[model samples]
Target chain A: MSTMTMAKALNAGLRRALDANPKVLLFGEDIGKLGGVFRITEGLQKDFGEERVIDAPLAESGIIGTSFGMAMRGYRPVIEIQFDGFVYPGFDQIVSQVAKFHNRTNGRSSVPMVVRIPYGGGIGAIEHHSESPEAYFVHTAGLKVVTCSNPNDAYWMIQQAVASDDPVIFLEPKRRYHDKGEVVHESKPIALHQARIVRGGTDATLIAYGPMVKTCVEAATIAEEEGRSLEVIDLRSLSPIDMVTLTHSVRRTRRAVVVHEDVRTLGVGAEVAARLGEELFYLMESPVLRVTGHDLPYPNSRVESDFLPDVDRILDAVDRSLAY
Target chain B: MSQPLQPWGGPPGATPHADAMTASDEMVQLLTPEGRRVEHPDFAFTGDDAEIAGLLREMVLARRLDLEGTSLQRQGELGLWPPLLGQEAAQIGSGRAVRDADMVFPTYREHGVAMLRGVPVGDMLALFRGTSMGDWDIDEHRFGQYQIIIGAQTLHATGYAMALQRDGLIGNPEPDRNAAVLVYHGDGASSQGDVNESYVFAASFQAPVVFFCMNNQWAISEPSTRQSRIPLYQRAWGYGFPGVRVDGNDVLAVKAVTDWAMERARQGQGPAFIEAFTYRMGAHTTSDDPTKYRLSEETEAWRRKDPIERVKTYLLDAGAIDDGWLSDLDAEADALGEHIRSTCRQLDSESLAHRFDVLFREPTAESEDDRDAHLSYLARFEPLSEESAR
Candidate 1:
């Protein structure tokens, strides 16, 4: 076991993936000698050589479209979308070509590629810097959307995402990247698509992912003192949400509340609510409620607590669900 | 037939001329505005009378398809159609010149090329009708999808050619199996970074690809003058490749140039740049109003050099195709127009249930969840039948 930050864990995970698969390549702006702006890919280019860890041109669409061609030619390219906002220039390649290559080829071609974006808000950053745009990928079909909540999961989930044959949008919480935790480096691997139950309770289930996972867990601790048991499920995989785990939790608790840092309107929470209503309708005590961010761009850091779903907001939603 | 003395940076095998005329003179027109064919010995056409008639038929059918598609867009049957009104010769000539094995990458406005490639007219309509993005398999059809982003297809073609070369399909020691790729883009697209980068890559790698630029004189509201000070094709010389200007309004000239380039590529020669100089006789698209920027006389001048009429006149003068054959071709064109109209109507009313199926080959957990949630939500309004319900 090794104690490391989420950024360090992700770096370790990338190293392991490179060691395991000779075909795995890493490419992005400043990812070679510069190690990336976050330094998550530090020393990778030197260790793996320039072919495997490429420092591509500052062209997002060029990087992505050529990577799609490379993937067609049988290479698993792990691309880093420099920032959340910078991904729009490459949106055409991602949505039109990379996302559709598999289905368009009828399984003859697969984009076994991972586009890593360091996203979400809480950092005192300028405009276009701290935005949570995971909903766009989640809304897009043929893409597997997943995000890591802590160091251990960040370490394991990245390798798993790379190993999967599907194209994955692996979102890294830019704010929580420095948070430290103990990660078990193991030979045995976990499935990439399953949700993890971070905390178990009998009252109501709190489903959160990425940066909101820690907040939901903290909310559960406060709820425990108030004699209300809150089950917190960290939805690791956003797109292929482990609905089995969610359905089972909703069945036992008979109530559900989803939490996320993204805006509330048509968010992933809405999909979860609608799905639970369809599959576990009779078992529910109340309608599925969502404790999410305001329907606005991530606000200034001074007032970000109001925009984000903190512990009190999550617990309040849990209490509201129980009252119903 | 006398070959015009080659000016500097013109096609090979000619005496270089001093003080070549301006950019306007660089538009090497072999067919006059009055529909007379001038001959250049070096770039002469060896195609028989039957081949010329066949090329004429292709240009006519391509025009008919373009007319029908534009009408569909106007009638609200299609979301948009980039009208290929006056550039029929450029598309048909270049599209037919390549071998069956050679690949083509086209911009969104290559309806004429799509027709020549035998892509079903209905399948082309799907994209404009908003029923689907593109409805053909690129590998199976040998024609790439209509890339909307300008100049991006050039890079794809370069990459495909490089892959082909790497796979020993081009530049082999036997020298018989090499293939070429014809990638199409417009004058405005020549200014984009990707297009220039593609040129650098293709030249550096000596990939078997042809850069076909249809300088249609206008890109939406921007005139050809706004795109470049010199003729677009001449820019290829800077990239270490031969470039030439052809009368894009003349089907014979277009065919002669493209055929030579494709042959060169197949013979283990590197890339060639062919600029088919033509005019856009209509608005850029259904939503565009061309009267805003273009003068009426410019349209009238190009109208006199109509590609279909030039071939028709040549055929009539030579007695290659009689009046009866012309009448039969007109009937066939009318039937094709009607077929496209009816098929477009049918497509609008038909339910596109497979829209999501092509979203992924193997459904990811997210797509599966999304599919399940969408189906259940849809079931609330329209309950599935017992036989089909899950």
Candidate 2:
């Protein structure tokens, strides 16, 4: 086991996937020489050669559209979206072609490609870069949406995603890119779609994913100090959510609070809340609550901290759930 | 015959040169409208009598299938049919140009190309018949699903070409070893952003692909002029590739140009574009009405240049086929039409549960639970009671 940042772990993971399979290719804008804007694919172009590590044109639609083709050609293409908001240009190809290729052909063919996007906001950045677009993709069927919150998961999940035959929308927590953690390169802690319980407690269940996983863990620590025990569950996969794990935790705790960086209404938190309410309705002691970003466009960087759901907002929701 | 739509800012008829139908000076025509062979400075008509007869047979059979499809739609057997009525030469000539190893990415209307790729006529009609999305195996036939979204397949074709490049399939001296990609779209699709971006990616990567645009003169209610101010083929020059416009009704010329383009790609000459200057003599699909937009006079003019008629005329004038052979070919077409009619009705209507089966390689818990719930709900309806059934 070695200690590394999430970004380095992701780089290592990409290198490992390239080494393991010759058919695996990396396609994106500025990912080659520049090593991606976040440096997640740094040094891969030199190691894997330009043929595998392709620097595509600035057009996002072209990047995704062609990647779908390469996938059809039997190549496992891993595409990188430069930013969360820039993915809109390629949205049509993703929803129309990539999402439907398998069902459209009646299971005869599939585009076994991975589209990686560093999402969520914490550090001060301009508009479009800091938006959370997971809800849009999670609403789409035939796409497996996942996010890694730490170095350990960043290393293992990237490999697991590349190994899967279905298309994965791998969302990386941009705020956690530089966060260091012990990563065992030998094996993954959990499967790609399973949820991980970070901090186990019995009072109230805190459901979070992506960047908010780290925040939930922090909130759990603070709640412990205030004589409240919070069970923090990191939801690895957003689309095919591990409802079994969630139902088990919420069933025991009897209360739940869902959190995320995306907006309040119609967010992933809404789905989690609704599912928890459905599964644990008779068993639960209180109603499922949500502590999420406000239902507004990502505000200016100066006010982003105020707009985002921090530990205090999470604790307040936890307090409310406990009050009920 | 199409009256020139006034150029973007210019007066009407001022850009008559832009009219694809009348702009014949730049087109490569090996077979004239009168069934006479003409000498071209660039392309050569190298087919012998047997090869020419083979082209005629395929074109006749393809047209027969198309006519059957139209009749079926009218007879309420099909939901819709996109007729390739006047573009037979463009479809047949280009469809026969590439080897079986080369991949084809066709728009929804390329039924002729699909037939050449070995996709059964019934399987192609299944999409229209609402029996299934498409049941044919794309990889087995080296053809992609018939993309309904306009021009989206171009990007897939370009990317597949790039894959060929990475696999070292291009620039092979051995002719049989090298392979490329052939993508077909219409003039209306030329205005799509994805189509232009495909050119950028193909040129940038030097991907082996041939962009075959069948300029069918009309895009539903809009004329070809609505899609382009300049000729559609000339757009390739801006992206640093060679583009050629051929007389789409001339089978010999379309085949020759597509062969050259595919050869250039296989030889690592990057991408090439071929604009088959043709006409869509029928409505865009069964639901459309040509009388709502285009004039019959224009349709009459294109009728004189009928692709199949010209090929049949050429064969007769050259003594390549006799009346007996024509009757035999007609009988073959009749048999094929009958086969399609029978097979289309026999297509299995898949169960809704089949959707959960194919939605993912491995079903997630959510999908599984949903499927179970759906099945249980369906099971709640008791099997028809004996008395009720009677």
Candidate 3:
């Protein structure tokens, strides 16, 4: 076991992927010698030559479209969209070609590529930087969306996404990039798309993914001091969704709350709420409440903490659900 | 009044065409509009009578398919069709220059190129007919699937060419073995950022690809003049690659220019660009009306310079084909058009209900549930009444 940050774990995982496949290519802006803005791809270009670790032009669509072509020629390419908002420039290539290639060719061709985006807010950034753009990718039919909260999950999930035959939108939590944790490489890695139960409790269930997993875990810990039990479930896979684990937890607690930093309307939380309503109709003691960001755009960093859900807001929602 | 700006590479006394192109900077030509054989400084067409006749046959068939596709849309057999009427030479010339080993990335309007790449006429119509968005086996044809977004395929072609070069295929000793990529787009699509970025990557990586832009003068209602300040081909010179402008109405000229560019790319000379100066003779698609934006005089001028008329004229003037051979080609085009009409009309929609089945290699639980829910909801509807069936 080694102690590392999420950024370091992700870099290690990317290096392993490059080593495993000779045809794999990594392309990103400022990712070669600069090693990405967060240093997530540091030392990779040195280890792997510039030919394998390419420093692409300042065009996102070119990176993805060319990656799509390379994938057609039997090369697996991992692309990095500098930030969450930056991915919009490449959205056409992603939704139109990268996401649709396998379905467009009826399984005859596979685009085994990873589009890594550092998402979510907390770094006191400018507009277009601290955006949660997961819903756009999750709504896309052909793409498999996933995110990791800790270093261990980051290491395994990065490798798993690169290894999968499907094109994966691998979202990294920018705020949690520096959070340190243990990564036991020898331990059995979890499935890329399965949700994991972070904490076991019976009073109520807390559902979250990516950065919110840590918030939900914190909420559960604080709630225990007040004689309340909350089960925290980390939904690693947002698209396929671990319905089995979700139903098990919700059915046991009979009350639930979903948390995320994205907007409440049409966000990942809304989808989870709908699924809970469909699967656990009469079993629920109260409606599934959501502790999430406001429907408005992510506010400026000055008021972002207020706009984003925190431990207090989650506990407040949990209290309301228990009251119902 | 200020003097005209000389073309970037033309000589001092050369008269420029449309901001920058001289007579010396003019494209390669074999069969002129006057049915005369001409020579070009960069390329030549040395094909014999049999090869010329074959090329003529392809042009005839492609024109027939294009006309029939528009006819199908007018007859309500298709939702839409983008007619490739006046750009036959631009497509066939570039399409034929490609070897089977090379890859092609085509825009949605490259019906002629798709036909030459061995994709069936029926499959080409699938997208407009509302059946599929092109599910052809790309490996078998060495062609990228049809891309609807304008100019996006150029990036794919550049990347594919880069991979081909990296694999030691370019400049290989094996005869007809080296591969290159040819990407097709229209003048309107040239304004897209992806297209310009493609040039950067192709130049930086020295990818073996040809950027074939059919400058058909109109991007729907917008003219090519509105899209660029200089001639379309002259823009590539800024991107550090060789670029040329060809007479799109001259089939022999287009073929020669494209052939030279492909050969250059295969020889590890990096990427090349060809801007085919042509006109969009028909409406952009079934939904558009060219009369709203274009003038009859402009269309008439291009009609007088029709690519097919010049080829047919040259063939007959040279006694390369007889009256009987011309009649045979007409009959064959008629037969092929009839088959296309019949096949499109008889397209069955029963299989469309299962389109979600092939959406993924293994259907996710959410998608599977979505499919099941939709199918069951469809079961609630009553069968069509006799009067409403039509």
**TM-score on alpha carbons, each prediction:** 0.76, 0.96, 0.94
DockQ of each: 0.20, 0.80, 0.68
> Which clashing pairs does model 3 show?
none
User: Of the pair 1 and 3, which is ahead by DockQ?
Assistant: 3
Return the candidate ranking by lDDT, descending. Answer: 2, 3, 1
Which candidate has the top score in lDDT?
2
* iRMSD, per candidate, in listed order: 3.4, 0.8, 1.6
TM-score for predicted model 1 compared with the true structure: 0.76
Top candidate, metric TM-score: 2
The TM-score between candidate 2 and the true structure equals 0.96
TM-score for chain B considered on its own, for each of the candidates: 0.89, 0.93, 0.91
Which of candidates 2 and 3 is the stronger one according to lDDT?
Answer: 2
Per-candidate count of clashing residue pairs (backbone under 3 Å): 3, 0, 0
* Cα lDDT, all candidates: 0.82, 0.89, 0.88
lDDT (10s digit) by residue, model 3, range A77-188: 9999999999999999999888887877766888889999999998899999999999998888899999999999999999998888889999999999999999998988
